[model samples]
Target: MTRLAMMLSAVALLSGCAGRGGDLPLQPASALGRERATPVDATYQLGVGDQIALAVYGEPDLTRTYAINPNGTIEVPLAGTIKAQGMTIDAVSALIRDRLADGYLRNPSVTGSIVTYRPFYILGEVNKPGQYPYQTGMTLEGAVALAGGYTYRAQKNHVFIRPETGGGETKVEATPEMAVRPGDTIRFAERFF
Candidate 1:
């Protein structure tokens, strides 16, 4: 009876170990696809290391491309420094217009666009994992392609991503159309088999 009880206890422990208790929850591939399908606040927020082109109508001197400084501000001639971080393109344009309207221009018609996006990082289980230039509408598959595709032992089903906006790392099933955002860190998981 004692031996049978010990065997049952060992079996129970083994069963508990077999259960996925510590693994990160992974979002289904279709879930990511559905997320991509839904249009949520599609505005792109500016951040440090992003290059922006600002144009002021009828004012050639004030129209130029500017890089967001490390301090998250951009210095405009005559208008001084304006905060651009975490602001949308239109918001930044409006702010610049307001600043220039303050004795700088009669009616500052300003428009802004992103010239270049910040780079994204990829690591683990890829052939060449490192920072790569971010392009608009880039997908995770494209990012993997940029990283020279996955390694032989890479887990092709899912990957972990840490967004640039700051959040806990998410485990998401790998899909071809998953969007990749600027400054995101993507980590490919290795296969256990």
Candidate 2:
């Protein structure tokens, strides 16, 4: 379909976007057409593609950092290996703290932050449509920019957000302020004019 047509048609699909993780909070990056946006739990689950930064208070020896393995685990000094998938960031922090307190270190404090959210896909009408990482609070316009902006044939009037539910309920007036969820499929259509 033409860029304008794709945009116009896709805008009508936002109302139907859904994701796969039934219990997981739906980030804009998650695939669509199955579930609604889920809330982030107090703890963060370590995923395969997730990047993390770890720190310990006053203990560089015990405070090392690493990304979770493709299998959803990480390697540490004393802790050996730990599975982080499905565990909240807080949960991971506490585990580290306890491990350190248990002879690994003296009254160690552990903390971790998610450094990467992984890649989400965008197709149809974007200049470089494909997979892009999910940055916190990123907007539709920013996503488009990452994809190399709209094509000359892009329909500037309406952009559709397909959430994997196979369609959407979003209006034609979606703006840049709208949060770009993970796994969201944005489509730009051709203008009638």
Candidate 3:
């Protein structure tokens, strides 16, 4: 019985050393600044590849949908090129309004909203790991599902997420309800039996 107890204690110690189901190297969320923090607010900031539906009140000519260019700018009629990436919907609308007010219209009521969010990336230990279009209220488990679910060798307990806005990667305990933001990169580690 004493020998069995010692073996069990060793196993417990080893498991603790391996971390909560073998966590990989990743930065903590606390290390990120507010500018690079994950989006938990109501409005998601725009990014490249995001489709935006913009409207100009009473100006059908200016109402249309635009995909944010890779360089983070959009081409608006009369406004020429306006930067939209990293900006919220209201900010982009105001920009359009101001540009139209610049001798184009008496008062332009511009409104904009995200038609589709940019894609998120998933890598490591998955059946199909690659970039997938982001959906609202997506979670880490859903992302894994999009990537064809976890492989038999997947760790399955935690994941590493790197924010696209230039913050350090963070390792988080994996759960189906954990919210995922756009432009995030997820990496699933391999399980060690």
Candidate 3: clashing pairs of residues: 27-169
For candidate 2, give the lDDT of residue 20.
Answer: 24
Residue 12 lDDT (model 2): 75
The true-versus-predicted C-alpha distance at residue 56 of model 2, in Å, is: 1.8
Write down the lDDT of every candidate, Cα atoms only: 0.84, 0.66, 0.81
Ranking by TM-score: 1, 3, 2
* Superior by TM-score: candidate 1 or candidate 2: 1
- Estimate candidate 1's alpha-carbon lDDT, on a 0 to 1 scale: 0.84
lDDT of 2 by residue, 31-148 (tens): 3222323333354345666777789888777666577777879887887787887677888888878877888688887888877765567666778988898776667777888999
Candidates, ranked, lDDT: 1, 3, 2
- Candidate 1 lDDT at 85 equals 91
**Residue-pair clashes, model 3:** 1
List residue ranges in candidate 1 displaced over 4 A: 1-22, 29-42
Q: RMSD of each candidate?
A: 4.6, 10.6, 7.2
Model 3 agreement with the true structure over 1-193: per-residue lDDT tens digits: 9999999999998876674545445443333332132444546688898899999999898899999999999999998898998888889999989989999999889988788888999999999999998887777777888999889999887778788888766776676667677888888877776
TM-score of 1: 0.83
